[model samples]
Target: MTTPYLLILLVIGLGAGVSSGIFGIGGGILIVPALMYWAKFSQHAAVGTSLAILLPPVGLAAVTEYYRSGNVDLKVAGIVAAGVLVGGWLGASIANQLNGHTLKLVFGLFVLLMGAYLTASAARAI
Candidate 1:
C-alpha cells in the first residue's frame, strides 16, 4: 500500500481503538462509517475488515478484567459466546452472498436502527 493509504489506515485504527477503549463498544460503529467516508471503502469491505480486527484478543483483556473482579459469568458467557460465534458465521456467509450495494443498504439500515435504540435507551436511563 502507498504511504498515504497506510497513514489513513493508521488514523482510522487509532480512532477506532480510542473509541473502543472509551465507550466499551466495538470498532464497527466508528470504523465502518469512517472507512466508507474517508477511505472510500465499500460498506461491505469495511464491515468485513472490521470483523477481521475484532476477533479473539479484543475480548481477552476485558474478559480478564471481569474475571479478576469476580464478575465473569463463565457459563452464561460461554453459552452467549457460542451463539455469537455461530450467528456471526452464518451472518457473514449470508452477507458474502449479497452484492455490495445490497450489503451497504442493509448494513446502513441496521446501524441506524442500532444507534436509535441506543440513544433511546440512554435517554430512558437519564
Candidate 2:
C-alpha cells in the first residue's frame, strides 16, 4: 500500500485498538466510522473490512491486560465468543437482505440509542 493509505490505516488501527481496550469495542465503534469517513469506503465495505479484523486481532491487548488484573473469566468468555460467532453469522445473513438505506437507518438508530444511554449513565454517575 501507499504511504498515505498506510498512515490512514495506522490511525484507524490505533483508534480501534485503544477504544477496544478501553470500551470493549473496536471494529463497529471506531474502525467502521473511520473506514467510512476517512477511507471513503461504502458502508457495506466498511462493515466487511471491520468484520475481517475481528479474528486477526484476537483481543490480545485487552485480553492480556484484563488477564493480568484478574478480570478475565476465560471459560465464560469462550462461551460468549461462541455465541458471538453464531450471532454474527445470523446478523450478517439478515443484514445482507436489507437495502443500504434501511440498514444504515437501523444501524444509526442503534448507535444513537447506545450513545444516549452511555451518556446518561455517565452523567448520572458524576
Per-residue lDDT, model 2, residue 104, is 77
Top model number, TM-score: 2
Measured by lDDT, the strongest candidate is 2
Encode model 2's per-residue lDDT on 1-126: one tens digit a residue.
889999999999998888888878888878988888898887788888899986677577678888999999999999999999899999989888888778778888989999999999999999
Tell me how far the alpha carbon of residue 69 in candidate 2 is from the true structure, in angstroms, after superposition: 1.7
Per-model C-alpha lDDT, please? 0.82, 0.87
- The residue ranges of model 2 lying beyond 4 angstroms of the native Cα positions read none
How do the residues 16-67 of candidate 1 rate in per-residue lDDT, one tens digit apiece?
Answer: 7766656766666788888888899887888888888777646776567758
Q: All candidates' TM-scores?
A: 0.80, 0.90
